[model samples]
Target chain A: MNRRKFLKQSSIISLGLLACPSLSSAFSLGANNDVIIGHNSHKYKVDLTWGNLNPLHTPVNDCHEMIQDSKGRIVLLTNHTKNNVIIYDKSGKLLETWGTDYPGAHGLTLVKENGEDFLLITDYERHQIIKTTIDGKVVFTIEYPAETGKYTTKDDFKPTETAVTENGDIYVTDGYGKQYILHYNHKGELLNFFGGSGTEDGQFLNAHGICYDNRNPQNPSLLVSARELNVLKRFDLQGNFIESFNVPGALICRPVIHKKDIYFAVLRSKSAINSDSGFILIMNENNEVVSCPGATSPSYQNNKLNELYQTVRLFQHPHDVCIDDDENMYVAQWNSGKTYPIKLTRV
Target chain B: MRKFIGIIIAMLVFSSCEKQQKEVTSFLQQGEIKLTNPRITVSNTLIDSFVTLKPEIHMEKLSVGYEENGKTPTEASTKLHTTISATKPGIYKFRAFHPDWKPSEVTSIKLYKKGHIPNKITWKTSANKKYKGQGETTLINNQKASLEFRDIEWVGFDTIAKATVSFNRKTYIKSLTISYLTDPKSWVFPPASVTLYLNDKDTINVTIPALTEKEIVKLDDIKIPIEKEISTIALKVNNVQKLPDWHAGKGLKAWLFMDEWIFN
Candidate 1:
């Protein structure tokens, strides 16, 4: 039978079993297999290893950011009403919950310098940047100063994500409220700010994500995710123009660097306004897409073909992604509305 | 025997007179013509220019008026200016119609001799004045509300310098007070301007420094007297000339930080 027929029959059987408590467990188990991977698929193998990190006792509203610290612990940042950051271990056990300070926390990063780890959080609601510790201690706070020449008035600025270099230089992307990257010195001093709101080669429409690449050590590059423009621009240490790369997907959230490889957690734009399934894309140093199993199929309108590829799985709004030192990937989803962090181990 | 008879006759007359007087007063009161229950119904019929499947509807009607005459009576209208009054307390149907549109769903209101006062307005902010950093500030009045940005970075036009205010909800927001800290040396344009969006639509645009106090444009939409509620206010700066930096000809190291928002 076709996939639709199979799904229909399975749904009927599951609905009928819902009335029987004992049969419910069996039905749930069968439902897990309902995710059918078609032949000749490029999607990666994703295992729902662990979950259940709901702190407010409500379903997770929006998992906008996620990262892994040096200790291999996964930290998930959500845009829920309270308890924005939820920490979990590799085994999916809830370790701790923090970040009641930020209501609309959108982006999160764990900056490791020397031997200390600093948690950098971006507040989309308040339009400020905050640096704290893993235990939710506020180390430093940086509000938008009155010295940036980019804003004409005081009401047009909202910062979404930030990137910090090894030398303590910080670059923050004002994605929502304003379109400029405000640069600050290591001491939280406004050194200078560059880039304006535009659709030009160097300018950005929505500078949603950012990262500092210190691979060369001598000259670190600032990789900015110009989300609306669908391109990532690389800037030199002095904020000079360098290069750009096109991201395959539309809604690219965050780019995580694991060793030399860059993994982008991309949400495929649904044909309809709010369709949610998306997947992850891994790219190597050469910018070539590293095909993996369980990646979701590129969906299109009026197309009934089920392109169940290995590299593309059924991911509903993949917001942020992080990889451990071992190249294991963790993705936080948005529309899924669950606080559980998804894990993808490289086979 | 004469005295006893006289006492019984007097008691009966007094009792009969009292009963007749009560009947006459009751008849007069019932005959007085008055709009017993006057009510008004308001609704937001469209959302995003489309007919909302579930339109928001509210009704206000009660007994709080006096009889003008035995046939003519008047009632106080609701704040919306649309009202209906009944000659007597009973189940009344109200329906509103928009030109070139289908009639709204009929609503039945039961008028009584009692009325309820409007709900008291309560306001709250996700991040108040004492709270620093970025978060949503909500002002709630009844079911209608609005949201304002607190401590958010404002960038556009030229560049925002510094903004400060203390929001007081003593009355509904009659006007949004914005204070700017711009350097005269960095004033590229003599008149710096900004626009405020209520819901993605431009509602107000005003220039800074109010040189004559009348230079500021009091927006019409803003005159509706913002209800005690939370509304999402989007501020955008426009027509600003990029000023040169004082240190060098390069762009100035200027930023805009909103310290507070005052809705008065």
Candidate 2:
């Protein structure tokens, strides 16, 4: 049949399938019927109704990122000006919500210093990184690094994510604007900057996420996500390129390290951006893909991993995943119709 | 959205045991199992000799079904396992299925046979400056663009686009296939009409149907058959002058994107 006829028939068939209960029931699973996803030992039981709240009261647009606080609270950051930050407990119940000032809130990172929890929120519209207390008190803000001579105006510095070091240093990724990682001391002074937007080995296309990798305390490094290129890049403390991991077919948003594993919220599968193709990826300490929830099983041949793609349509542009103490995953999505985060209880 | 609700209702229908059904329904009501599009990798889309389709199927309970004649892939179609070789030129569609989850949306790729390569092309109307791909060498380069409309291989035009394609010599071209992109979400629609004048004498015209709903980004091919030998061809493609009322940009001119033209 032609394209037009095929589309017409498919819609009719969809209507017919909806009317026939028995035909649709063929998709139902027996034996406990919990929606289990992921591969290997990292499998999880999906909980779609987690963190749901009234949109009129606690509205969210593009639930951008999530982080587990020191007290085990799941703090979600969204661009919705009504409530930019929503704090939820592990049980998916809303504990508190704050911040209408962060209209472009996209990233959330919780850092503990001297027994106090601090939240680093990146606002792309404001073109600055705001450091605030866990209860929404502003501490300080890091504006666009005009001292580095790399930026012409404030609009050229759309910071997407930030990573802080143990010695009170800051690393900010200008992902949306110019793709540079600006390093600063605790005083918010620009020390240096590197990794501009280019095809070079050290540069990036969309340096969307960054995290201070202290996996090996002796030689700590920064793991950055070049989203459009589908690669995780490692840079030393002094802005030196260390190595890169090529993850084909997975547009990873951020690298979240929990225990000996590295978790990434794959933004979209394949090259279609708005196709609602996304999943969760877990990698071992050796950078080997162990499990991909809602995606194909991980496999490698001759040390080169195969391209990973989504198999289950459970996530729509998963931007971040926060692993709780019990290993439950709270996934925050982007462009998912203002829905709340979906939690994955580890089985 | 109905498909998502159907899975929950079906769970209530299939779990025959009362106790097991209760436990299942309670947990499943909070969630629904919606499957993603299965990944299909073709060795090459520009089919010169033969192409291999390798689908990654991990579990035995799941299977990939496909159709070659431009039909939507269903579970009842031919099951694809291991690797399949295709020597002929046609569009191959694939979809994955499992017992407990909704079947995936169909993924397709068109395999075109290598034909006469036109060396030169002259432009009559200009492409949009932002999307002028490689000047005049864009259409005959045989390179495929990604689903993103910003791909450098695609030349975009919002008005009538006219061009003259020239062959190295007087070539006997049986048919000409024009490859274009349709991403309605990006306000890029298929051409309203594509008129081709073969040797300035014979003319063939094709009109694409108006889009009724939202469509996923795709690269489509339309073949216009011309049996006679041809030396030069003039092509005129008209954009959708007015988008339908359902679209957000209703009554506005829609953009037209063309990447490559294959002659066979």
Candidate 3:
């Protein structure tokens, strides 16, 4: 036993304290898993060692994103060139692994076109985005659009994410590079671009992630994260600024929408927005945050979110999150000691 | 009237249960916190005065986190170990904070440093044995971060940062490297000038340029190195007097983190 446990046991034995197992266990009743996180409609049971694999051969530099495929297999993307992608089953068992060409594989987006599912993988180091099949076959690749005249060189096109439309058109956010979102048609032709690096409304600082918000089916909009500025700006499909809202105390990454709710991998809290501070945020259909997984419980006073902070240091730079068919969450972190994704099962 | 009172009590109990659930939503369910008696371990006796605290986390950047003042509920506070020196030297029961989801356990630490060898203050703390004293000696470690004792309150003329080093005999010191963590959260703005008094005789004033970044930066601009053999070394700095108006700690003194003096 550790020193603290020994001290407690010794004190109890000396004082003739009787064990109260039944009473102590009654308060911590959490279905199957004793530990519980989140609040309201988003509470979950944490499983830290869910997707841990041996690091001798299959090592990871940064666990970036995870997604559930059409076959219900959980797919994870990492920067480790040894195996950039690892496919797993729902039961946390390693199914298979593939891809070696992606050294800085960061973003993973699943797109279904013509009744066949494909993957869009963004490479930060190579400054390119590749469209591939589930079997790791590259179909087409996109580089920096020289026609846009915004980028001086190919190095300025470090795209981080891509959101595909129903017609195969894609919107790529140059998050780490020029902070612009480039729009492309089905044939990889540049159509328009929006956002630059600034504090202006139309501009963004570290536009890390982007996704299409189809919650309002009649009017679909694009939700992009200005991570450093702690705001999520909404833009029309043609790349026009619509509105922007604040996510207080969240240095957020890409916005992930699962079922009726929206989720975000908060890279850092507003109070301690440093290198190794991060958490997870969950919002209801009304865009009101109902739960913060690794931080303080979400609270709102007069429609404004209270400044959120990390009460539990569970995550270090959480880059992305993937919600499965069973409402479980698989979180991927960046620069968190080369650890794998953690699973949070909904209780 | 009795039935109404009974219903009100039942409603209050349910509301309290819901409140408790919401409070523990952000708490860790899997991890267990065990805090031991705090120790200040110096890795290298000759030049290293680093102190490793309990419940350590990799502290790249620092913000004034929750302090376990013992009375505050554990679920509401964070455990932090900071080193503070009293005005005079004596044995002290420094409070240790160990906070968890449940009640916190405050441990009182008792340790001694090599104090007052003779006419000069001779501090003989080594790597093997740990000392629990503060002042005139900066603490640093490789695993986590510095204790960051300077990041509290809004006070000007905070004059406790005078580091003194005493040697066994006269030793040659041609050059030295001063290591410090230049983090932004704690507003650790590097000092503009460093004054060093060596051997109770000669004094050297080195001017440092303004710091521009948030990451840790070293000062190697001390042009004329220490050319004489000296038995004692005392150092001080002229720091920023006030914080910027745009900062949260506006009009207050900014904090500076300094550590590790390497003799070359």
Candidate 4:
């Protein structure tokens, strides 16, 4: 079956997945060296043509995150209900789009299960963590944890993002709720929960994002966003606290690891929280910020990163970054006037 | 003839200027206060519960109760929620004085429920669906999650990020509690100000101070004094578009984040 035809037949377009128009600023490579974004070996070229579809049909709002599945399809998750999940091939052609169950659909994570692909989504509106098939079938649903004695009401269970370990253990970050990280088994039973809202070394304020850190490969842990403190905390997989590294002046939404480097969407640059004062951060395994795309270059004095800020007008409240197999980056923005995802091909 | 014409024009201009000045003065008098020693008056008294005062100012000291000849004024206690009340009602006098300002005349009121003063009101953000999230329900849901700006619970707008909530029908509301986040590292500052509309009619304008990590601000009778039944409520937050003059990313659009619009 052709991918575009599959999308047209799936009720994805007619289902009201409205996307705001594209926010591409007209520029040519010959004019300004394209501003040459990225750091060290992770630099990229801006490719505006990448996953653009006519907004009248497949529209996207707040392209939150993207992931490449085993079939080599680029799957993008958006809050836009027209098509909650937009699947595109490497060439930027719409292969298919599915799902309408997630109105506050956020945090797209793809994992291969015994040669099969599954998608995990955290819905802020529903306050539930939904595990679904790539085709959008609800496989498992994890409601808010009550037995933990942490949450007093349903309103206190806002789940923002999720991460699954190699052995199929899932960690859900209640970044918007009580600011705790819940560890669960493959069947979706809570195994452990840790982290809370505070300014302490391990406590998190606006623990907005989370991910499984496999930098050690042998001893994997979790990297959580203490966004308000402008830092990322590392914790052992069992929910034990480890250490925290500061990205001074960068309210990073998430830490995206590609190969040996980690990238972040600096949600804001100055001390402010949700402004268009954002840029991209690329750092090495040592947690040292190497480059700041669309902002001032990263600098370190005595191992402390200087307070960084946006120097370019490229992005407004960029939320997340997804690195493709070819090291290409897809930048998703929140509150950016409904613009489509921006593609950055590795230079 | 030329001299007479010039005099006539001058007279017209002066008369017009006088009318404009009067209008401007009236507006300032209604909206603002001229600082005196203690220009305080008791607007309303809810018996032994709370007393609403008018002409509240940045004060060095304020004490209110009542006084008699050759007697000291009985000072009422204050609460953090902005309340001051007396156990008994009598000849109530309010004495407020600023160290740097001129002395003010004492404000005295006779207590009477029938016609002595106005009244008071209060509101709270309850867990209910009587108020529905109007546009971009994702950022602010029925469950009241995602009120802040993150990848999870925020909607994008061009300049101002606003969230409208419609009541079940026409409803009365008095108080509101709003939460906001400002991350300077990402260049997200607090909103320039927050404006609220009731029934699309009256407005409550609030300016955000320099915020830290996260803050939940509660507004009621003192800070915001509108106790009316409004059908529709609109909360408009201004995104900080530029950095401060001394910062590096000055004059840039800084994203504003808001959450948890609790109305009582």
By lDDT, rank the candidates, best first.
2, 3, 4, 1
lDDT tens digits, residue span B1-264, model 2: 656655564444444334444445434432356566666767767777888898878654889999999999887899998799998888799888887687877888888887788877889999999999877888888776766688898999989999988887888889888888888878999889899998888889888788775747778877888887888899999999999998889999999999888888
Model 4 lDDT per residue over B134-165, tens place: 43443323222222334343333325755566
Best by lDDT: 2
Alpha-carbon runs more than 4 Å astray in model 1:
A1-43, A54-59, A152-155, A270-274, A292-313, B1-264
lDDT of 2 by residue, A32-151 (tens): 457678888898887777889999899999999999898988999999988899999998899999999998898888878899999999999999999999999999999998988988
DockQ of 3: 0.05
Candidate lDDT scores, in order, read 0.52, 0.85, 0.67, 0.65
Docking class of 3: incorrect
Number of the top candidate by DockQ?
2
How much is the lDDT of residue A289 in candidate 4?
85
**Residue B108 lDDT (model 4):** 48
Candidate 3: pairs in clash: B50-B140
Weakest 10 consecutive residues of candidate 1 chain A by summed lDDT: A304-313
True contacts recovered per prediction = 0.00, 0.31, 0.05, 0.00
- The positional error of residue B255 in candidate 1, measured at the CA in angstroms, is 35
What docking grade applies to model 1?
incorrect
TM-score of chain A of 3: 0.90
TM-score of each: 0.48, 0.79, 0.62, 0.54
User: In order of the candidates, what TM-score does chain B achieve?
Assistant: 0.25, 0.80, 0.40, 0.39
Better of 2 and 3 by TM-score: 2
